[model samples]
Each structure stands twice: as structure tokens, then as C-alpha cells.
Target: MGTATLLLPPRARFGGQRLSQSTARWLGRAHQDNVEGDPVARAFDILPRGWPVAAVTRQRDAGDAAGSAWLRADPVHIRPDINGARLLAHGDALGLTVSDADALLPSLKPLFGDAGFPIDAPVPTRWYLRLPEGAELPVLAGPARALGADLFDYLPDGSQGRRWRALLSEAQVVLHNHPHNAARVAAGRTPVNSLWFWGAGRLPDHVRSNFNEMLGGDDAMQAFAEAAGATAAALPERWRTGEGHRLFDLRHVRDLALLDRDWLSPLLADLRSHELDAGTLEFGDGRRFRLERGQRWRLWRRPIQSFVEQSPAGDAPE
Candidate 1:
């Protein structure tokens, strides 16, 4: 991987998270670049929030969301909270099947349809609302942003979302009473009791990325790569040589252990032998650790954890 810069996203649990041996070693020896932006968005030059991801991912998953405004109406599982309902899980965790979607969506379509919001579920887990060009939208963030968080906090706010809020309430009522939800409850499975509306926008006229190719990303990242004219493919089992700049989006690697086994281990070996030159390991928490072939000799540093490795109780970890 000559001169190819490899980048990874921030770890979700970095505050008290332990790094894998290989990950700890490589990061410990690297120098912090002190970069200050969401690394993934920075890579694609998209905003950290409010990026038109629904339209982008729709282009990949469904192929028909372009040339119009679109918003994700993803199926979600929410639980009641004292404050309000809290978003529990969505997408893959819900195990949404086409049959499940078929069982749930029919009664809800006319609600949006009558209100001039055309909706469809091109894929089982991903649904889209094709809003008219003249329609207005509030900030419709992705469901991931609200995972395990209070749903009302992330819901569209104020007058802009009044119509959406009303429709969403109606949809929730419909899903809550559906026979499918009862069957799911009987089967010990969580019901897809709500819909998440987010990523609202039309596909942009242009988008670009510095990387020549992208590795290991979801539909949205693939769409970003495609829109920017960059080649994309599944992440390989191990690091390999490549022709141009390559990006490995690690957000999907929920477990840091897999990151060490599949990536950081191989990276350290290659970087030491000059098989891989230099690159940056960027985290979303505003730190990009930089290292090169020659710099790999620093074995004096201890295993690093998190961005700064501070303890939760204001003491360093043993």
C-alpha cells in the first residue's frame, strides 16, 4: 500500500473503551494531528449532521430516489419513557423483513398519500418518502443519532415539523395496533412500532471525495463514493496493496476487536517493514493519529486507549 492513506472512524465507546492489543500498539506510537471535525464527513466533505444521506443511500438501495426530495422513513422500535418514548433499535437489529414491512405499511401509506407525502419501502429496512419539490422540511437526522436516546429530543422541532409530527403520531398508532405487532410480541420479538423520518433532502448536484476508493461502508457511504466518482467495494479480510488513496470506514465495525484482527494488526506489520508507507487513523472525537514507516520504530510508548485515556473517576487506568 504505497503512499495510500488509511483512515478509520471514531470508536463509539472511546470514553472508557479499551483498545485491542494491535490497535493500542499502533496508536500509542503515532503522533496526534489534533484534527477537529467528524472524520467520516470530513473524508467525504459532507456536513457532520444534516447531510442529504437519505437521497444518497436511496440512490444505492432503491435507485429511484434521485431527481426529487427524499426522506428516510425507516422502521424503528421505540419504548415508552417517563419523559417520552425513547428510540430503542432500528435497521438490522429490528430484523425487518419484507413480509413484516408488508404487514405494517399498507394502512399507513394513505395517511402520507392523502397528505401529499408519497412513501415507499424499496428495501425492507429502508423506507423513503418522496416529498414534493415545494415541500419544506425540518432537520431530519438519521435514526442512528437517536439510538438509545429520547425520541422527542431528535424529532423535528417547532412549526416546521407540525405536519410531520401529526403524521408520525398517526403512523405510530397504526403500528401499535397492527396484528403483526401482536404476533411479534407473542413470538418474543420487538415490534417495529414506529417510523424514523430523517435525512431529508434532494440528491445534491455534485459531491466529491479525495480518496480513489472506499472500503467497508453501508449504503450511504457507498452512495457517497458513487456520487463522487470513487470506486467502492467490501472491505477485505486483511489489508492489501492498492493503486490510489483508499479509505476504510470503520463505523460499521461496532466491535473494536474485529478492527484489530482485520486491520490495525496488519497495518502495524506492514508499516514497520515498509510494506505500507504512512497514513492517518482518524477518530470522530477530533483526533487524527499520524505515523509513517520510519516513525513505526517508536516502541517506547505504552498501549494507548481512547483519545486521551483518562479514567472515568479522574484517575488514569492501571
Candidate 2:
């Protein structure tokens, strides 16, 4: 009677790679589909229709910003090798503890404070900075984009870009030689050598979503649901039966094989039993497929080969 949506990253199929058998079969059965240009952008589009809410800001404000713009100050590792420098995603910045953050805060907070941005470390990996009212902030890419890619292009840009750039440069130098990082290196762990700033915005008073419940690990999803006056929770071990539209955020799952066993198989069974009216699967690489119970009878459609098998050389699946 209602639609169930699944949002996942594009790791389902890379160039010349294929998904697990169950997932591939389900993709072939979908009745409607579209490709998005950016997986992250498309994933956000499925949320209860609202202005872009700053995730780090929402996490910091905890539903009370009192009117202030916020930016993420996520910890990161700059990997250097023959390929030069690479900024690891926040998740990949391994072994960084709260104590490490506390040790480095004194040395780093003053830099941001001097630049007029006050910093706060609610969590070790996810930090926040409060921007002055009416400050013009530059558009910066999320850590997802910076992971394993050149960081130069993803830096903040726009009116105040130069100021932010200078601050970031200074931060790198300070973090590079921090005693905490040196100790981390001594312990054979990746040192936290840089900070990432993005997702800048103020929390909106009102947000709306089609779903009655939002289930995921993402704080933004929880914050959005709270703002929209809906129920939000961490995903359960098993999906519970519900009546209204529901959104399941599975973007954190990067392994297609694991997703097939854990999610797609169960969902396929639900569809065949007519337990769900319709279901939509979104991939991180910008492709989406939708299937309804009635569409299952279209037996003429055959399961496709692995996405990698169908993809052209050096191109993503279409």
C-alpha cells in the first residue's frame, strides 16, 4: 500500500564488476529507473523535502542552534606516497581517540578562534565550528569526494575562499608537527594530520518528509526526522512491519556481496509475498531502480550479468 525506499552507495557495481546474484536479479526486474549525476546529491533528494541541512551543525546543535551557521571540522589523514598526497575519509582516519582530540585541541582551537570561527569537539572524528552571523562561507565538497582524490579541487571556494584556504594551510602545518600525531605515529597508527570543513548551514525550523519513519545511522537523517515531526531510530536487527512510507538508509554498506545477503534477499522475499507495495533501490554512483509487486510477473525480463560485465570500458554502469 505504501512505498519502501532503500538508499545505498554506488559500490554495488564498479566498472566491469558485478553485484551478487540476488541483487543483479532484482535490478533486472525493476520497472522504472533513472541515473543521477552525483550519488550523494541524489541520496539527499530522497529525504523529506527540505533545504540542505548541515549534518555536522545538526549533530552539534542537537536540535538547538539558536540561529548560527555551522561547519564540519572532521579529522582526516593525509597519505603521501609515490602518488603524492591523498586525504583519507574521516572513517579511515584510524585509531584517533578522544584523548588525542583533547591533546590537539589546545594547539588547534586558537587557530580557528583567531580566524573568527569557534571550534567544538563533541566527538573525536566529527567536530564543529560556529561561524559568525551573516558570514559568507565557501562551497566545499564532503569527505566522500575527497577520499583518495586530490584535495586541491575540493577546497572551499567563493567570496571568502582565500581566507579559508590560508587557514587550512596553516592548520596542516600545525597538525603535521603536533605532539599527538607524533605519538600516534610511534604507535604505528595513521596520524591525524588535517581537518576537513564542509556541510555549512543553519538548521531550519521546519523540515518535511514523505516517510513516517526514518531508519539509519546517519545523524542527518535523525535530525531531519526530528525537525519534520516524524519517528527516527537506529536500524534494528530485523525490519519491523509498518504501515506508512519508510526510508532505509544503507549507504554505509560498501560491499555489494554483504548487502545482497543482508538486505536484497530479504527485500526480494518481502516483494514476492506481497508484503510490500513497492520498493526503490538507489545506488551511490547515481543510478536508481524501482520495482512494484505487480512487475514481478514480467517473466520475460532476464537477470542481467554483473554490472561490471555490462559496463563499457572505463565507464560507470548506466
Candidate 3:
């Protein structure tokens, strides 16, 4: 018997009424539990040293600052509105390229250097900035939380926050007039407007995991697997025979319609054929449901309207 686990975002958005019928059915017959902690943190907990996003990702580039305080310096687009500005969306939605990154780095390097932080871009969309050791920095939110949300409330605080906020303002001004952004706008693409700082901290000394394999496109997942001495590979379209435990991250399936077509349907078929002994589904928001081969016989467990109920106002679990 083999076991597999799937990690995904919440099946539905906050206040969203439409339920994923197939997902609901799958969860209805499974043993469910609401795990506590950030999904990224939880995923890291599965690995040896746990979730050190900055350290693990920095290691991918063999960064000198891998052991130092570091943060993700990812490029982002910000749209200005009457009230204020908000993040455009995530990188995947921006269609950024290495060429874009190369063209922009030199122009902005001085600004970051002058601000006491040096930036590095090992990949097109992903960037890193090394901070002074023991520097007081705010507990900033990740890009996911600020995606499509107002930037004002999400900015840092205190004297350090003031400096960081000013740095962002200066960067935005520079990016707005940069020839690269002008060319981007001319080419009918969203301009690379600003930089987002997040996922801060140094790498952990050690890490561990229960799984033998981890399959996903997620950088953090792959990094964690590598650190934990597990076989990490790009996610495959179909499951292969394996022993021990495996984790599949499918958070890229942004909507229920695509989730059904790309993942749920195929996974359910695999379950029906007994190709798998057991499987678990985790919505990053903390809800986890486990399904075993024997549970398939529980036909009386009718599918619910939604796999997760709308979290109470101001009480939603992270």
C-alpha cells in the first residue's frame, strides 16, 4: 500500500458560495482535521529543519548570504487607484522573464545598495536581498496575503518600517520611469512596477521529513525536500508507483473548474481503482481531509455544499 498527500489552497474563496461538488464528495467520506499554522510553515514542518523560506531558496543559488538574514526581493506590479495602490497579482500572473529581470537589476541596484541592502536575482521573477545581521525588521506579510489587496495596511511599521516604506516609494518612482517599464507598456504587458520584500530569516541548522519523495513546482517545497534529503522532482501528470509517503502540491489549480479537470477527477479515478492505499488533501488554510481505500464504501456520506464553510468574520484561520 502506498500513501500520497496533496497540498492546495482553500477550495473556495472567502464568501464564495459555489461549491466544488467533486471535491466536496471526496472530503465527505474522508477523515478530516483542521490543522493549525501557516500552510508554508506546515509544509516545512514535514521536512527536517522546518520552513526557512529565505534560507532554503537562497541555497538554490549558493548565495553567500544563505546563512545570513535574507528576504525574497520578488518583483511585483502595483496598480494605482483613487483610494490608493494594490498589488497587481502573483508572479505567475505577471508573465515575467529573465530578460526582464536582467534589464531592471542594474538600474535599481544602486538604490538598494544606497539603502543598505544589496539585491540578487538568480531567476527571472525570484530575487533575494541580504539584510544586516540582527537588523530590526517588521513581521511583514507574504506576497500571497497582499495579492490584490491594498498595500498601505500591509507595509511594515516603526523606524525600520518608515525606512522600508520610503525605499519602496523611491523604487516605484524609479521603476515607473525606467525604459524597461516604458517598453513593457508599449508592448501591451504589465510593467514591472515595484519590489516586494518577504520570506525573511536565515536558514535553519538542520531539517527533516517523513516522506520519501516530494513532487511539485513550488520552489519552497522543492527546497525543503532537498534540504531534508528526499527525492524532489517536478510534478508529473500521473502518479508513479512508490513506497513510503509522497506529497503533491497542486495550489496552481486556481479555480474549482480547473481543479476538477486537472487534479480531482484523475485523483478520484486513481482512488476508485485502488491504485493508492490512502491519500490526504490539505487546503493551505489549515483544513486537512484524509481518505483511505475502505472509506470509499461509505456511500451514505453525501457530498456537502462546500468542503470548507465560510470562516467566521475576523476569525478565519491563516
Candidate number with greatest lDDT:
1
lDDT of 3 by residue, 1-318 (tens): 477888887656523444476666665667767788666456454423334576677887665645478878788988889888899865677788888888898978999888778887887878887887777645677787678888767777778788888988988888888999899899998898888878777777766777778998877778878877888899887555556688887766566665566666666667778777778888867777777767666676766555445332221122
TM for every model, in the order presented, reads 0.84, 0.83, 0.84
The lDDT of each candidate is 0.74, 0.68, 0.73
Tens digit per residue, CA lDDT, model 2, 56-113: 2455345446577888877888776676568865743476677977988888889999
Off by over 4 Å in 3: 14-26, 46-50, 238-242, 254-258, 272-274, 305-318
Question: Considering summed lDDT, which 10 consecutive residues are worst modelled in model 2?
Answer: 309-318
- lDDT at position 95, candidate 3: 87
Any residue pairs clashing in model 3, and if so which?
Answer: 47-208, 48-207, 48-208, 49-206, 49-207, 49-208
Model 2, residue 173: displacement in angstroms? 1.2
- Candidate 2's displacement at residue 263, Å, is 1.2
The digit string of per-residue lDDT tens for model 1 on 1-318 reads 554555554554544556776667667766765576445556676533347878888888877876788888999999997899999989889987889888888878898899888878878999988888788866766776578888777777778777778888999999999999999989999898899998888777678888888887466767789888999888776677665678876655555666667777777777777676677777655556676765545666666765447322211232
Rate residue 29 of model 1 by lDDT: 69
TM-score result, candidate 1: 0.84
